[model samples]
Target: MQTEASPLVDKFQLTEDHDSVFPKGVPWVRYHGKYNDLSINIVCPGKDSSLGVDSVGTVSVSLLTYASVQALHPDIIINAGTAGGFKAKGACIGDVFLVSNVAFHDRRIPIPVFDLYGVGSRQAFYTPNLAKELNLKVGKLSTGDSLDMSPVDEAAILANDASVKDMEGAAVAYVADLLKVPAIFLKAVTDIIDGDKPTAEEFLQNLAAVCLALDQTVTQVVDFIVGKSFSEL
Candidate 1:
């Protein structure tokens, strides 16, 4: 998680790091600082305790979001990260997107209304001016825990009409919605899931360049958010 977030943290100069307030052995990391006059905090689900690797996926993100919201009381949340994209959806490696909607692709409940709940569709906060000014592509994002897609996941994602997919976006959206906080999702394309290259190979190859794009785009977004009201966004 820190690897993905490093560029943004560096670009924002978020030097004052705050350790997690959670119980001992929890690995959430928080960095607090200012983006001009705007107060900003960057939270990353730190390494898994036993595994010693980035604690990715929905559970870690959702838990950290809940804790961060309760502690920081942030007015807005930016869930920025890299994601797999679809060439069919006009995505190219290193392209950045502002998510318009988010949903789950792997939670197959199969019941009537529960099926809909399984999908967990949620629209992101409206930001027409921000999108226009940033000149970024806007798309629906589908989230699942798997790094690789299965046929069922593929069908679910297509049904949701998602252009991008990641491990954490929808989870963060769920928390933000529950807390009534506006959120912004900025995703950079790290791999093309529907393309010829293997998913992991492409993702690893493009990660560095994609992170650069993500860093630059997120910086622009924070700059845009400065001095703006929620209604203005």
Candidate 2:
């Protein structure tokens, strides 16, 4: 009833990547080191090889749907991708920080929550215990239709006490809550985003690498879920 199978854009091709340590592939979808109790459903945006993803909400919902339909309902949902880090924290390029909280600084009730487009929304923040496990990297995740990071936006993120901004964290939290599942965001800081024409190529390449205490974040994410295959933890 919850929009059977995937509510994502109708486009996808599941080839095989045996190069992964998990089951079908190392990424996209992988098996947890657990003995048949779990596997990971890794999803990314803006990647040429990734399946159809029109918006953050769509991708998150579809991944959840796919997991349920395929009976791969992961105990935890991990959102891994690239984000623009605010300068306040001196975030290094390729650093991996776990999202402990997501503040929706875009929402406002001009008069009183009556926008025809929709009410600006917010996502559920991470638990304090989870934060401790993830190494306590506070960040702000900004969501928008495009990757345009302006100085004004950067200032806004900094003002909101955010360390990084992304397009999908809000959507992922939106769907994960509905299914009552836990989701941890593992984001890699690529560059200092300021008001300018955003470059998709650079962002995607950064998503493929790391810069922060990455492995720990990954382990914490995997351990939080039903499937945990992190080599260290």
Candidate 3:
């Protein structure tokens, strides 16, 4: 997780650690500083206690987002990370996307209204100008806990018309929406799920480059947001 977050840490010089503001036992990292006169807070759900790895997925992101919202009351939450891209949607390795909407493809409930509820689709804060100005692709993003896609998940993703998929974007968006905070998702493609290469192999091979792309793109987005009214976005 830190590996994926490293580039932003370096780029923004977000070096003032705020990890101690939380309880001693809290398992997350927080850094607060200014980027071009706008206060910025970067929170990363830390390693899981038992497994000793990044606490990724919907659960962790939801909890972390709730906690961060309570603590900082940010105007907007930016969910920036790496994701699996769909070649069918014209995604290429290292391409970064500005997610227009987010949904949960893995949340399958077989009932009538519940089936729609299970999808949990939510619109991300619209930033058409930002997308156009940055020349970033605008797409729908699907979230699921698993890194590997299954037949069922694939079908659900296709139904959602997702161009990119990740573990935490929709979860964060859900929490932000619940807390009445606008949210944006910026995902860089780490692997092409539709490609012939094994998912894990491709993800590992392209992760570093994708992280760099994510960092640069996020910086640009931040720069664009600075000094602009929320209505302008």
Q: Which stretches of candidate 1 lie above 4 Å from their native place?
A: 16-19
lDDT of 2 by residue, 30-71 (tens): 322322344434333222235544324445444544454345
For model 3, give the 10-residue run with minimal summed lDDT.
15-24
Candidate 3 per-residue lDDT over residues 87-203, each given as its tens digit: 999999999999999999999999999998889999999998899999999999999999999999999999999999999998998899889999999999999999999998999
The order of the candidates by TM-score, greatest first, is 1, 3, 2
Could you estimate the TM-score for every candidate? 0.97, 0.59, 0.97
Off by over 4 Å in 3: 16-19
lDDT of 1 at 18: 49
On the 0 to 100 scale, the lDDT of residue 144 in model 2 is: 45
Tens digits of per-residue lDDT for model 1, 66-165: 9989989999999999999999999999999999999999999988999999899999999999999999999999999999999999999999999999
**Candidate 2 total steric clashes:** 13
1 or 2: which has the higher TM-score?
1
How much does each candidate deviate from the true structure in C-alpha RMSD?
Answer: 1.1, 8.9, 1.2
Please give the ranking of all candidate structures by lDDT, highest first, separated by commas: 1, 3, 2
Decide which is better by lDDT, 1 or 2: 1
